[model samples]
Target: MYMILKSMKKNKLRNLVIVVQLIFGIVILSNSLANYKYYISTREKAENASSSNVYEVSVENKADIFKVGEARDHQYISGEENQISTVYKIAKESKLVEKIGFEGLGCNSCQYTNEEENEGKFILKSKIKTIGIVEYSKELTEMYNFKMKSGMNFSQYYKSEKAEDVIPMLISPQLSKDNPIGSIVKLPGGGKKYKVIGVLDNSCPLLNELYNMGCLYKPNNGYFCVIGSLLTNKKTHLYIKLKDGVSKAEGKNDFDKKLGEKFETQFFGLDDMAETVTLPAPYAARYILFGIIILVLSSFGIINTVLSTILKRKKEFGTRIAVGATKAQIEKLVIGEFIIFFAFSAFIGLIIAKLISGQQAVWDFSVIGISIGIVFLILVISMIPAYFRMRKMNPVDLVHGR
Candidate 1:
């Protein structure tokens, strides 16, 4: 046993390869485990934004449902929607609905009106070219907890005719990082300036973040306003938080279709996977596959190395048998040496895996343990081949190198 240690020390390259292979295997397994945890967490978090027996929908109706909150009289196109509005107004007056809210949607595209300022600078997004309708929903804001990081939320003054209705804005994390917040962004049409308000939850749409970050850009007019027109605001989406006992998942197809017809548009069920994490899943899967492949390759290398060591020391094994070593003793010596090698390899691999994982989203100790366990299994399996090769050796002939 001491001779094995001395031999390993003498053959530094061989030992180094074994250690390296172990480390690689552990790192891959740890990363795979980390990724699995991230996806699971995401699923859980997305589920929380809904109530029990509730579902989420993203509506895109060309008809105007969201009304712009301006410091003046509200106006609507005298169309069939007005008829529905009268009915909804009556329904609300009768307390038939538990709650109601409206959010105005708007976007603006800006061209190189200020090319000198932006020509060389790397803008996170195109300059705003179009601006869409702005709406206010007290209930929507309260429940979503979408507070402005800077400036003020819509107050009573915004509802007054004398008050100059100002457009409150917010942005995404990406845009804010690219362009500092609290800066004024130029609009395409009127060259109106909208100040950065706050960055919303990271889960918020990047487009919304862009607006808050002042990185919003349009190629055409600086401002565009449209409310209750789902077809017009294609870029914007809606979120509905159901009250207790709401059943959008059940026999509400007729109701949903009616709403769809009233809005003159299609509604889509928005799944959580569609909303969060810009990181592509293919990359995660590729990492897992790569780790698995590396682990497999390392297992092959380790098994080969162990078997070669046992085979090379055949003469010593034969001598031990001739000196009254029982078959059990021989097997113990063989198995013990390999078990130690594998255990040592596993220890080193775990350390490497931990360092690489850091404090980010994924790989951990469990991954290392599983990986090492697999290595142990491979080691045992490989012993069978080595056993057959060396089992029939006659001590005398083995010692004489015949």
Candidate 2:
């Protein structure tokens, strides 16, 4: 190791160039891998949810029948409610519907506290705009394949105990990390405290989308919570999951006939509903392609530099061999130097990638493992030409400048 470092120091400019190329390659590769992993995971979850035959049912008031001027009138409100109820009734009566769920906005004035105590001392964690509180049914949990990382699901909470002042809630993984299960958080001004009964899995589609809500306009400042209550209000969106082997067209046809001509209903699959959340396939592919190109170019450059460096130092290796050093020892010294260079470069690259990607970066075991594997692969490939050249050199021939 000491000799390797001494040799590297003797050729500082050459080693510095290698390290810079490696750092550049690693930075781009890490960022690309992180994004690609995120995209694949998100797409997997969306595809899984879509395969469950779930569809979102959206009801809109007919623009022709409801004049724009009567939007706030009591009659308009009643008509809207009636239409939602009629659609709900149709969904309930349809045999194609295996289960139904409703999701709607929660209290706008609700403020969440990170405080653990129930003594009314509240430390505001987030406001209404940054935090999304969704009221949903227990069936929604089953309909969309919601998994719990810890604690109990909404059904378990529903069966346990009922508190008038405390509401049982399931929070997203991001929020759950800060406020784990059994954490008592109050929604001040509403006279209700939210009890964290469940922590949702990271793969939950709803939470995933909610977590990425600020990708367009904001800096990803969003948290999500779900309460086990079905809101039948006009603003509530309905979800229906079909039984196995049932086609969406069948459900749509039945719903269209039952909803009549007064109300308009539209259906959206999970992918369609989450189009804004997941990264596009083409973009992810392009990122990965660019990263691969950089990585390959950097690897080739390093290989050429290593081969050149080895050729220049043939007299040094020959002198070492004449002094009783074996070929294996020489090879080990060369490999060790590159390993150190790659390790330092990778560490620096990871930090830079994290800084650039910000909230979107993923640093899981898979990413780290793959990055390490790629670096080692590059190291081995870069040593190939040098290894062959060194093997063919004879101490006498090298000393004679042959």
Candidate 3:
């Protein structure tokens, strides 16, 4: 052990270079691991957040216009009757449709404020559903867990003894001013003042990212998968939560079989949410790109010191061989030194990788494993040839300073 330590100390630059390489590899691995973990976790949370026993019916009709553009061109089909109410009635009759409720579309009057306006108001303009407070449990809030900064989900909005008098409402925190919810929102038709019962959320950065996403995109977690739902003309983009261990495909299948022509609904999963989940090919490209950057920086010090050590030790090596040291033995000495140094360096590098990955929360265990594996692999490849040369030297000529 003492001899090994001394040998490493004598070659400070070489040891340091190898250590830096290990550190780089570990950092990459840790970050990757954490990122993957976040993705898997968030996706599962999204899937399981709701009861598996529950699903929704999106009425794709003029009365059920979910998108603003659809409503813009739509002329009401049935007169003197509530079209949405009628659709809800048919949907409720479907075998697959279980425990259905309706949330009436809000008027723009209730969506706009004295301070600012909400983009979600577009849906409100299209006509919306009104829900009973108790019925809201599975209706409005059972999707992704948006970190709540204030106010409960609109779960209890319509459930009450004062259902008539309780005009309570929930809006995104931004919709609130220094205190926007308590104030009445101006109605689009004018003269109607809707009471703002509460503000939504203003917590994690993850939530902010989700809020910015296009209607099609839902953040997988608080960090990336944010937009849990979207609305389209004649279609209600329902946010669904499957039971734990249920596949989105399976859930969609169940929905179709059960609903059966009552409504034309499209079921989308994580991949469908975006442009199909990305290829690891791109992930590999990222790894290669970032790895190249890290490796180049690491190689400079490593290459410089290794070459310097080889040059400086030429004489020592020549003498060792001339004194009848076997070629294999001489080679082993050179290779062995590097092997030990690299192992230590790789360990330290791994620690650094983990520390740096703290913020990312990506899982990178494989990266770390590969990195450590590569460190020794590179050492063996790099040092083996050098060892041969040192071993093949003509000691007598070398000693005479050839």
Candidate 4:
């Protein structure tokens, strides 16, 4: 160990180059693995959503008008009857429709202020930054597999009609830090109050789904409130699950025939919707390719450096061998020096990569295992040329400068 440290100090410039290469290689590889893992996770979630056999229906009122030159030309001219409500009713009555739900953009201008009881007076806390809101049905919650952090999901509130005075709402994990379960949050001047019946899990599928559909800018920073009743005045989208043995095409055709020319409707399956949302396969593949290329180049550079170092130290190694050191000892000494360099490089590289990726610095077992495997492989491959040279060493010839 002392000799290894001394040698490293002596070859400071060379060792520094190797360390830099190792660090760069490790960082690239680590981030690539992370990206691949994330892609797989996202695809799995999308597949799960697809397995639910849910489809989204976008509706457009035929009576609405649009002009080429006018700003905000798409004026929503209200018809005598609510076309969306009629579509919902028609879907509800259809034999092919198993479950149906509707959702719409909630009040974007609304603000949520938490009221805290101080002594005998009520004080308003700071207003929470509301990103956006979605007015959805309990059926949509079931369709998206939304889990709750605390309290009951929308199903309980929707069926039992609990907390009749205040509107039942579910806030995201980001909002739950300030507002706990059963907390009353009011929309200032909106003349409506909301009761936090549930706090959604951090990994809410509904939020992810909505984000895919461009409904929410940020998935974590949003709120979900149960729709009191479906109305055509509000622009809404429908989530419909067809009965078993019924294809999506069949369902779309049936709905189209029923609605006729009054409303424009487009249906999207979960799989198709997910394709637009999740990371593409090629994107993740590019990372993996770049990582592998870096790893190979780094390995080759290290091997060349190791071979050069061995060539230069032949006389020193020969002297040691003549005195007492065995071939195995010399090999162990060289490999040990690299092991130290690699271990240090890996530690720094992982920290740097985590910072760059904006992810937590927590090292999981899989990451640790991969790091170990990489170090081991690089160590073995880089030391091969040095090992062969050391084995063929002739102490007399080496010392005599042969």
Top candidate, metric lDDT: 2
Candidate 4 per-residue lDDT, tens place, 73-192, comes to 243324323445656776888889899876765665444344322211211122444445667665676566546678776666667764477667777766666667777666434445
| Model 1 residue 111 CA deviation in Å | 32
Question: Can you list the residue pairs that collide in candidate 2?
Answer: none
Candidate 3: regions farther than 4 A off: 1-22, 37-266, 270-285, 292-308, 319-329, 359-367, 394-402
Q: Could you tell me the C-alpha RMSD of candidate 4 in Å? A: 5.3
**Between candidates 1 and 3, which one is better according to TM-score?**
1
Model 3 Cα shift for residue 211 (angstroms):
9.0
TM-score (all chains, Cα) for each model: 0.50, 0.73, 0.46, 0.78
CA shift of 166, model 2, Å: 5.4
Q: lDDT order of candidates, best first?
A: 2, 4, 1, 3
State in Å the error of residue 208, model 4.
5.7
Best by TM-score: 4
What lDDT tens digits, residue by residue, belong to model 3 across residues 112-172?
4543345333222212222111112225444333344565444443343244432344544
lDDT of 3: 0.45
Give the higher-lDDT candidate: 3 or 4: 4
**Candidate 2 per-residue C-alpha lDDT over 1-402 given as tens digits, one digit per residue, 9 for 90 to 100:** 888899888878877887787778787777878876766666566666534788877565556455543433333324545555656788899988889877765654444343433544442244333565667766776665556788987666766767556667887766766676887776544445667888876554563253353232111244667776643343456678888988878888788776555546677777654554564545756766676566667778767777787788888887887788887888887777768888888898888887898555567989878877787787777778767877776767766555
